[model samples]
Each structure stands twice: as structure tokens, then as C-alpha cells.
Target: MYEMDGEEIFVIDGHVHLWDARQENIIHEGGEQFLQCFYDYHTGFTPEEEQWDIDTYRHYGADRMTEDLFGNATADMAIFQPTYLDDFYDEGFNTTEQNAELAEEYPERFVLNGSFDPRDGEEGLRYLEHLKEEYDIPGVKLYTAEWRDDSKGWRLDSDDAFEFLEKCADLGIENINAHKGPTIRPLNRDAFDVKDIDDAASSFPELNFIVNHVGLPRLDDFCWIAAQEPNVYGGLAVASAMTTNRPRKFGEIMGELLYWLGEDRVLFGSDYALWNPDWLVDQVMNAELTDEQRDEYGVELDVETMKKVMGENAAELYDIDIEAKKRQFRDDDITERFDLGTHYGGDAGAAAD
Candidate 1:
């Protein structure tokens, strides 16, 4: 992990997703919604209902994520799960089995996450348990917003979702990442928001709760949550937001966040299935973080902070032996053989493939 400067860096990208069109029982509109969610933020670009298909996910997400992460510059590792699978329809809002196969092919660079709809009831818990036993999943992702009762979404506070969280807690699963609200569709009052769920984390203080997208409009709430509870952590996956609406403004607020939270509680994540990762990474890497601010926040430009932002904190929070995972990748040739698609450019988004 040590480079020529004797500084070590073990980067584990906290967010990544896999989408493929050729899998059995695959759904296209569901896939399109997923892309739309990202395009809404990333390219400030959205496709009409008719243009997004299996092909869109392949070109925009599956192939693009692979190319951006492994086909170019590398990170030490990545944390990944399927996105948008649980909400849309049949076999909705979930990653295809092909994603698992992709993980098997690049064990070192990727950490797989399992997702279960709160609507699945007892069946969801069974599925979760089966995933733990059958696959080497290091974490579980729950979009409690999908379960908000008032929003007509699945309620995270439902007995079923609560039971699922209890199951995750019982399993000693250290981290659970979830979305806050609707991504693509215009923000609706009915949207399931995560601000009301701190009791879940407070109830499970031992669990590491990662509130993804920092809950957007509820960013202050998330910060309050993190300040109020050790179990709560916030992710800075403001990729699309930074790109589309508030590039400079987002950077300023993020810098302030680093100052206030001291960086350890804030993670650098690019919702990678959307725009090129380089675009997101560069946004922050080039942000105006001050020398004192960087030092105070424990964000060194060298390998150390890189590792922390990329994966180490996630590894610690999730309890995965990243070094062990690295060894596994080294022992196999699969990473060398796996190919994603075209990437952002040369050497900009490289990581351990």
C-alpha cells in the first residue's frame, strides 16, 4: 500500500453500481428510471421515456462504470450494490445476477452490497439471510425512504423494515447505506425522506448508519444526526448536484462541511453510474480546500487522505479486511481479465481492477 513517498493509500470507492441489459427477467423502464435519476444530476441531461432501454444502461451505467473505475486509473477498492431495482416494477430496483458475477471476476476492487425491499416482508429477511450465507456481501443497503408510509412508499418504520434492520444488526453488519428521496421525478412532498429515521440509528447505536446523498435538502439534519449519534455517518456523493445545478456552491458548502465535521465523518463518493467518475472526483480534488482546512480536517493531499476518502473509513465502518480483499485480488487473475467499456479518458480514474 506504500508508494515511493512511503505514504500508504488504500482507496475503496464507497459508491458504485452495475447494470446490464442481457440478463434474464430484466426490466427496461426500470433501468431507464435509474438512468434518469443520474442524468437529472450528472449530465443535467435526461432521456425521454422512449429512448432509455437496456442499451442505455449498458452504455451509460454498466459499461461506463467499469471503464471509468477499472479501465483507467484505479482505486484500491470499491463498494457496490444495485440501484433503482426495488421501485419501478417486476424485478424492479435491483441489480441483476450478472453484477454478482462481475464481482466474482474482480473481487479485490469491488465489495458487493445486498438490497432488500421492505415490502418483501418476511421474504426479504429470508433473502437477506440467504445473501449473507451465499455471497460474500460486506454490507447491506436499505432505502428507508422507499418505505415512508405518508409518502405512499414502503415505510422504513414498518414492522417489516424494522425487523430487517434488526436482522442486519443481529448479523453484525456494520454499515447500511440508503437513499433519502426520489431521484428523478420532480421533488414531491410525498417523497420518502430519511430525516425522520434517526431513531433507527439511535435504536441501533452499534450499527454504522450511512445516510447516502447526505439527505439533500436535509443535509443539516444529517449533520445534526451525525453530531448527535456516533452511529450516523454522512456521504458526500454530490456528483450530480455538483455537475448540474451548484458546482461552485456545492464545493463551498462541502468545504465548510469538511471544516465543521473534520472530514472523517464526510466521505467522497461519486454516484458512478452517471457521469464520468473523473468529472466527480475532479470536482472535489480541485475544490478550494484550504491548507489549514485540509490539515484540520485530516485531509492530506497525499496517499493517506486519499485512502481514507476512497475506502479506508468504509472498510473500518463496514469491518471488511481490505488488505485481505486485496490479497484475494492479487491471487486471482480475474481483475486482469475483466473489462467494462470505454472510460472517461486516460489514467484519470484508475483503481485496482
Candidate 2:
């Protein structure tokens, strides 16, 4: 929990990963490039003090993740967004199976999201069904740009993809998080385009299309689509990273989102590992919208709005009762860590350990 003014705000990191990019996991040059790209983002955008070396970044397992998110950071509950690059890694990069291990160990603190490749056809559907039964998955992370054997990438609007979406709706998976960020191996820049999302969101009104990174580098297009589609939402992962390095740009993006999607439809995410939630949370809570920014974008960044962006919005989407969960956190490991003031300088007496 993060306190601001006189209120305690619950934080839900809507996007996080537990990936293994170690040398052993790297199968080819593409895998190496992918890891290096992520490293550059970490080192370039993140504060120097917060940056980790290549080895640590590769295999920073569950213990470090727990310490960074639940122990040191202000994330009450984190949703694990799996990115499986089977062609690039031996065990696949951050598979749902791997994330489930952590979610199982700390069920109260994590939400495990599974994934599917439309290109996989019937076998993929079966895999998704198995994932649903095993993990009781509430959502799925779709990486449209992921490489298959022959195909470079797939789109959400594709016929096979629609079939998967239809099955997801049938199985009660409401949240569909699509990765429309940086390009990866065997995929072109067009593969990450947000245009496909507009079609998917329009076709599937029952499902919620949370565009991760807010379709970064194509924010205007995403905003235009999300404005018309009521079920479309914006997930702040890479966008929030800009808070440290490019706060003004972050403010501009937030203003655009607020203007188009409103406060309720915008969710906060630290994109953990690339960045930690502690500083991100602090930066967001402390950030202000200048009068010029407000006049330019026609929106206000007030306390209530911040509260919604920090946690309320995501909690509502995930069907979590924030107040009820707050009570349970009193005895959780986070409470103990916060009480000890051992995690990013939180108040010792804020909650009993």
C-alpha cells in the first residue's frame, strides 16, 4: 500500500513477468537480440541505481521478484503476463507453467495469466483448455508478434485468432491483454500494429481488450480506437517507464488516455523486471499535470484520479474487493517488510507486521 495526502492507496501491478533469458535459454541469435533489446530498455530508461547487470537480469528468479514487487515495491497483487518464445528458448520464455509456480506459492499475491498462439490451431485450443483447467486462469496475454515455425506473426483479427477468442469467451476468460509493443525476431514492425485490435475489440464486445503499453509509438491510433470501443482499455506498462526518463511525455500520454478512455478504463502496470514498482508508484503518486498539459489535453490529474489509476481500476476489472484485500494484507509478508522499513523506505507504523 502507498500513502498519499491522508489516504492509503492499494497498488496492483497489472503487468509483470518472471522470464529466463540466461545463456542456456538462448537458442539462437534472435534470442540473444531479444534479451539485449530488453536489457537496453532496462539500462537506458531505468535509473542507473536501479539497473542490473546482464547475468542478474537473465535469471532473476522468484525470490528476487518477490522482494522487488511484494517486499520492496508497493504491489499488493501482480498479474503475471507470460511471454513464451519457444523458438528462442529451451523451456520457453516465461511460460504460464513457470508463472503458475509462483502464483501457487503465493496465491493471495499473484494472478497467473495464460497465453495462446492462434497459429497453433486445434492443438493450441487444447493447450489453452488445459491451462484454464490447471490454473483457473482469469485472463490471457496475447503476443501477436511471437514467431512460429514458418509464419512470422499472427493478428487478433485473423479467423483462427477469432476462434481462440470465441473459445476464451465461452470458457469465461474476459480479459484479453494484447502485446502491441516493440518488434521481436522473425516479425516486422507491422506485426505490432494496433489496427488489428480495433477489429478484435469491435467483434468481441463481451471481452475486454486491454492494450498493453497503450500501443506505444502508435498512441494516437490506439486512443482513437479505444475511444469508440467501450470494452477497450489501456494498460500502462512501458508507458509508465517514461515517468523516470521522460515525465513530460508520460504526462502527455496520460492526458491523451484520460481524454479518450477516461479514468476508469486506464490501468497501471510497472512491467516489473524492466522496472520496479516502488519508484514507479512513487513517481506516479508524486507526479502532477501542469496547467499547460491540462489545457492542451483537456483533462485533470487529481487525487481521486490517481487513486483509480493506481489500483481501483484494475481491482474492478479483476473483480477484486480492494477494501477486503487490504484487511488481509495486515498479516502478509508485505506488511512485515513495510513495518521493518526494509523495503524502499516505507513507513514502519503504516500497518502492523
Which one is best on TM-score?
A: 2
lDDT of 2 by residue, 1-353 (tens): 67777676778999999999999888978888988999998887788888898999998999888888876547778999999988888998899998987889888789899999998889999999999999999899999888777788888998999999999999988899999878686344486689999899999999999999999878989999999999999999988888887889889999999999999999999888888896788887777778899899888878899889989988887889887776666666656645534222234444346
lDDT of 1 by residue, 1-353 (tens): 22224443455567776654334434446455555555555445222321334346544544455656655444546677565444453454446354676676666567788877777778878888887877756677766544222354554556767788888878766577877644434345444466556777777777777777777766666666667777777676663346344554565556555544555666666666544454445444444445655555554444455456656777777676866765554424434444311121112223434
List candidate 2 segments past 4 Å from native.
186-189, 333-353
Single out the weakest 10-residue window by summed lDDT for candidate 1: 340-349
Q: lDDT values of the candidates?
A: 0.58, 0.86
Off by over 4 Å in 1: 1-8, 20-34, 45-64, 84-93, 147-151, 181-192, 239-247, 290-306, 321-353
Q: Which candidate number would show the highest lDDT if scored against the true structure? A: 2
lDDT of 2 at 39: 90
